[model samples]
Target: MGSYIGKTPTELEMAGNEDEEDALGFKLTVLRDAMIHLRVQFLHFQSFYEKEGLENIGNDLKAMKIILMVVQNKIEELKSIIPEYLEIKNIGMVKQKIEDFDLVVTEIVLEMKEFERDNFLMEKVEKLINKLNPFDVPNLETLDQELSPNEMMKTIMSKSAKKQQDKMNKETIQNDVT
Candidate 1:
């Protein structure tokens, strides 16, 4: 909404070296835009077919998935553009950090790639919305208490959070006794 609207992402805001960030940012944005374009293209295909008829969509899905994979590979490629940072002193920890970094980056990119796919869905969503009448909404607003936040939303404590709290309380009680 501010200065970043038309400008590229600044070097420091990104994780890699400044030159790498600059170069990669431009390239990534291009690829990201291409991904978005493909998404739009697919949506247009979907809408054209939905309104007209279902042409063979099998190849279309395959092509879209391949594009998604290329985008994923590019995301992994960014990690290579910079030296890896190690949080721990040991070699094993550094190795683990590398794996962890890969996992986190992959997770984030995959999430974004999913959004690419979602954008395709959104482009054709209006037609879908029109196609689907009010009766098709599945009445999920009242399906489950957890899913609904209507005063009846029951919260569940995850096991680890509960265990940590219990351990803290036990430690506090022990300290008081001492």
Candidate 2:
């Protein structure tokens, strides 16, 4: 055979190993960067949630203030009514004013109930945000050491299957009850 001036088989094998390691390192870097981006997005969502909740509260407060003024005006009108001069017309006017006051009060009560429901929903969203906090994610080193991509995929698939099974079970139970 002609004299080879190139790397030997051992050197070539080592070079292949180095390339593999470099590729793995690059992939790890990319993963780290992606995680950082995800964290930033989570933070943005949290800020938006808080801002939106505050604005909703402010609007609700303004609505309440307006309702309060309406109720106050109705009260003043009732106070001005002279019971000593009770006539058919005055009595009818008083009844009309009372009905209007009742309607306003009913509307305020309904709005309060709606506000309470919205608060409950916001609380649920807050809990979800807490659960999805990116800072709670396992460190990259620990994650890499503990689970390979295949293992992670298996875990996710198993969880999904369990959830689907649970949903089917619930449906069956409901059907039997019905």
Candidate 3:
């Protein structure tokens, strides 16, 4: 079992800008946590599949389903950030979406790959990811920047728009039953 938790994530490129560095640190922090979460999830599923036989690993499959749903919601939230992605133009919504997607994707993609046989889906995801420009996503450092009043207000809209906090809480458990 290889570990996904590698050296601490750092924006080695941002050594030039202190402000950028700070924001990058926050982003990387979020990425790190998400990575760890996904790693644990994958490990759990792998074990479950092995023990129960992949054909009967319903519990493990359900867990993946849950993660996918949450991650999809998160992607929707982050998509709000880049106008290039979708119809929503609200900066807050976009930031929230980005954060949400970041949270889920960092954790699940590597693990999910074990189950996926499709190359097209991976291509689309890669495209969307490449389109992202980090500046559009907000962080505490971004809010701290001094700016014109109008600029501040436009930015204010994004202050509260992340999407992960909107996930559905499923109390019902999935059990194999006829």
Clashing residue pairs, backbone N/CA/C < 3 A, model 1: none
The residue-by-residue lDDT of candidate 3 on 17-122, one tens digit each, is: 4544454445534543443444455557667665876577767767765755554554553344244323223434435536545654553455355455532233
Local error of candidate 1 at 178, Å?
A: 55
Cα lDDT of model 2 by residue, 62-150, tens digit: 54445444444544444354243242222333333334334434433454456556633433333323333323223324333545576
Candidate 3: deviation at residue 92, Å? 15
Residue 104: error of model 2 in Å? 50
Put down candidate 1 lDDT per residue, 11-41, tens digits, no spaces.
Answer: 3444344344346445445444544544554
Off by over 4 Å in 3: 1-36, 82-178
lDDT of each: 0.42, 0.44, 0.46
Clashing pairs in 3: 77-97, 78-97, 78-98, 80-94, 81-94, 92-158, 96-162, 96-163
Count of clashes, each model? 0, 0, 8
Compute the lDDT of residue 15 as modeled in candidate 2.
72
